[model samples]
Target: MGVIKKIFNKSRPSNEKDGIFFDEMKKLLGFKPIALSHYRRAFTHRSSNKTDAQGNPINYERLEFLGDAMLGSVIAAHLFTEAPTGDEGYLTKMRSKIVSREHLNELGRDLDLISWVESNVAPQHFGENIHGNLFEAFIGAIYLDRGFTYCEKFIHKKVIGPYVDIARLEGKVISYKSLLIEWCQKEKKKFHFEVYEDNGVEGQKYFGVRLKIDGNVIAKARATSKKKSEEKASQRAYFALQEKINIK
Candidate 1:
């Protein structure tokens, strides 16, 4: 609470704006931001055919990069301070889990980050990474517009406070493909995923699926959400390959 207050130190009386973004900020943050431009850039998708006066793409990609670094640094510092006994490798792995693309995507999606995204591309056409990328970009904007201290505080508030449920995240499987890759490496088995289109009925919708395994179709899944379908297929593939893998 103190962290967030310090970040958005300015207090103001409501003047006019009454929308979800403002409302959400008021409900969650209790203060209207002094700078809306930074927040707008946070959710700006690259697909939007928008550019700055310098002809640079006006999107969140750069912001995402900056945010990613800031996030990693803050998280690493936190882990370093909290886990005094953890070695470098342990810290690296823990940080990876925390700042992972998959995890960030979930955080962004769960927070409805897309709701504020400014884009020319149809929202449905966006890939899964958009959520995570926007999240990172937003963080970067916060850092640049504010400062490291404010950025860290905002992350702890918006990220760690509401979403960093450590126990669940520990047991949560972020990437089935990663697991399958590790398993294959340990088992010395060749594996790959074969993706193909799966056109739906006349009125439904088009979709795709991938068959993955150790030189065999051990798992098959389809979904309107390609990532979900891929993850499902990967999960099946993981189960099939699990027996062959030895955990060192």
Candidate 2:
């Protein structure tokens, strides 16, 4: 109780603007915030370089880590009960797909979490990952401010109920490169990915990948990383051979 009171007292919004902000937050969260500091830290970017009274660096990164674990735990439990017939490998794959970076980024975008971020850096300069990181940090804040039950409820409402359709998830491919490779091997098709360093605009070094199937270039792509370039190339290849890929 003393700790909770201290947190509330330390950063209680001191203006009408803060009051209105809390009201909006209440509507979004479905509860009055007991520790507004947690949510504030959740939305704070590392660019702010904030520190607590104890001089410990405070940002959303740590909260994001905790939230990731919480999300995985809840999702794993759900999968375990929903698919009793699934073996260890199957369950693990499903969880990976559900908690994938792409999916989390989508969820964060859906929530418009970026608008709430407090940062010294320009919002436009931030990467696509900022959205997902904020969402995870928000979940961590919820867990700390409320409890595991509220955290689970939020996950169920936002993640499980709307997004996690078991049948649809089973067919979902989290990595296009892996899927493409699997298809190639299964079809006994000779495939190779030749990756080369290709520097681009602003002198930024990039990787160019050309995907060859049976000695023919199926797709070519470039990205900041070899793996990303390969994945991009695989995505194009998957679309080109969508009919043969046998995925709907």
Candidate 3:
């Protein structure tokens, strides 16, 4: 009898940890999840090295891709309805602003979603981008667990309701670098972002960029990455030439 009981217990699934996860997810999702397995996959990091019976690796990357598509669809629909007068370019720009990676990272951090991640890598080693990736995965999980309606509702409640504002978003610049380049092209002025130096302590290195317009240095900036430094320089150049650019 003891041996039989032991075998039975060993084969049984544990509920204690899953119950805690369910409650936490309920609070975050604003509804009880019908399928917990999907949510579990959402929070799973690639480093966990988990796999399914079919030998397919399980992680949030696939979910993230699906969520990206869902988010684009829903946000595009909302933009279409809200801005009836907007042309294709206008609507696209607005949607981009709303679903920008920076905005997604902010949303994920607001929810403290990183706390639920399952991974072999230490939390401290993760980059800021993980937050946005997790948020997208969470949305993908929602879509799979409850369908499009529930997924749309979650996005509306968490993203569109709280953050999106048409007026504010219109003036928002998704990429100052792009804006600066456009302005320079229109004005028939040549512009360049040159890496001047790389500086910083061992683990933390900063790249310096100089923005030159028509052979004249316009702005100089430094950041952790060359791309970031170039963007910073471009932003500074834009502000400096704001009057000339006539940007609204």
Cα displacement (angstroms), candidate 1, residue 90, comes to 0.8
TM-score of each: 0.59, 0.64, 0.64
Candidate 1 residues 1-248, lDDT tens each?
55755644455424555344555654533335545567777777777767889998787888888999999998888888767887998789888888888879866775667888778778778987877987888788777666788788888876765445333356676777677777768778777666687665654343456664456677776554667667767765665554566432
Q: Candidate 1: lDDT of 43?
A: 74
Query: What are the Cα lDDT values of the candidates?
Result: 0.70, 0.82, 0.84
Candidate 3 lDDT, tens digit per residue, 1-248?
Answer: 55753543343235788767777888899977766789999999999999999999899999999999999998999999999999999999999989899989867876778998999999878898998999999999999887898899999988886567686588766777898888778879898888898865666576779999999999887666889778767766766676465653
In candidate 2, which residue ranges exceed 4 Å CA deviation?
Answer: 2-15, 172-248
| Residue-level error in angstroms, candidate 2, position 194 | 43
Screening candidate 1 with a backbone cut-off below 3 angstroms (N, C-alpha, C), the clashing residue pairs are: 63-137, 64-137
lDDT of 2 by residue, 40-81 (tens): 899999999899999998899999999998999999999999
Worst 10 residues of 3 by lDDT: 4-13
RMSD values for the candidates in order, in angstroms, are 11.2, 11.0, 12.9
Model 3 segments more than 4 A misplaced: 1-14, 172-248
Model 2 TM-score, all chains together: 0.64
Backbone clash total, candidate 2: 0
lDDT of 2 at 40: 88
